[model samples]
Target: MSRWRRLWSVPLLVLTLCVAGCAITVPSDPQGTLDRARGGELRAGASASGELVTVDGSDVGGSLAGIVEEFADSIDAKVVWTVGSEEDLVDGLEGGDLDLAIGGMTDATPWSQSVGVTRGYAGVPGARGPVVVLLPMGENAWQAAIEAYLDREVTR
Candidate 1:
């Protein structure tokens, strides 16, 4: 093969390898959100809405709380629910006091820009807009898992 042909072939092979789904795995952090939540408690800070985060402490209804309960059960982790305002929930999640925060969060919520927030979900009744969840910033795995679960549960 000509020198130019060999050089071009090398680049092509490299591109092909990159495109072909090379199994690159970055080990999960032992202390990351998912790991921590699984190993310990799944702390959730939720603001009291009509029923989403009921102050009555009844598990009979509400979208956000129901989903959280399911998640806690799925992971076999205990849930410590803190019913408070949005600021309180966000602060808890940011301070690592909580793994997830749920309220009547909408797309216009200021927290969306600061930390990780879930997509708007229409899982609750009497909601003015779609609800979202506040998460620790850059917690990709945790966010993805939450999103997937919500999609599966809420859609059904």
Candidate 2:
């Protein structure tokens, strides 16, 4: 190949590689849950599950509640809690009325088919098994964000 042709090809290859490397690949969120939650209200459903979550009138408190609040703060969002039974929370998640649900849910939760469940994290007081947080189905970005927060918190 000619010298000029070779020099031009090298620059072009480098540019192509740089562009490919810089490309962002965001996770899919069909319902835009994460987008809406950022710098906004995070609709969270809480079920009574012992120390993992406690509901007193409109107030929610417990280990899991603290974790959820911290996670919401990390994203510049405020949590709007809804207290209900496990079934009701799952229904809210399925219907897109809640961004997340936490109530000492475990890996063995039967509502997995209807919602997105985070990977179970251990260490919650009084939890029967690894505890999980549930989210709306197919909100991959939202699920990932919550899971990432849980991963960091659970490890600490």
* Candidate with the greatest TM-score versus the true structure: 2
User: What lDDT does each candidate get?
Assistant: 0.76, 0.89
Candidate number with greatest lDDT: 2
Q: What number of clashing residue pairs does each candidate have, in the order they appear?
A: 0, 0
The list of candidate 2 runs beyond 4 A from truth reads: 1-26
TM-score of 2: 0.82
Q: Candidate 1: which stretches are off by over 4 Å? A: 1-5, 9-13, 16-31, 57-61
In terms of lDDT, the poorest run of 10 residues in model 2 is 19-28
Q: Candidate 1, overall lDDT?
A: 0.76
Q: Give one digit per residue, the lDDT tens place, for model 2 in 78-132.
A: 9999999989999999888999999978888898988888888886666678999
lDDT digits (tens) for residues 83-113 of candidate 1: 7778887888777788888877776789876
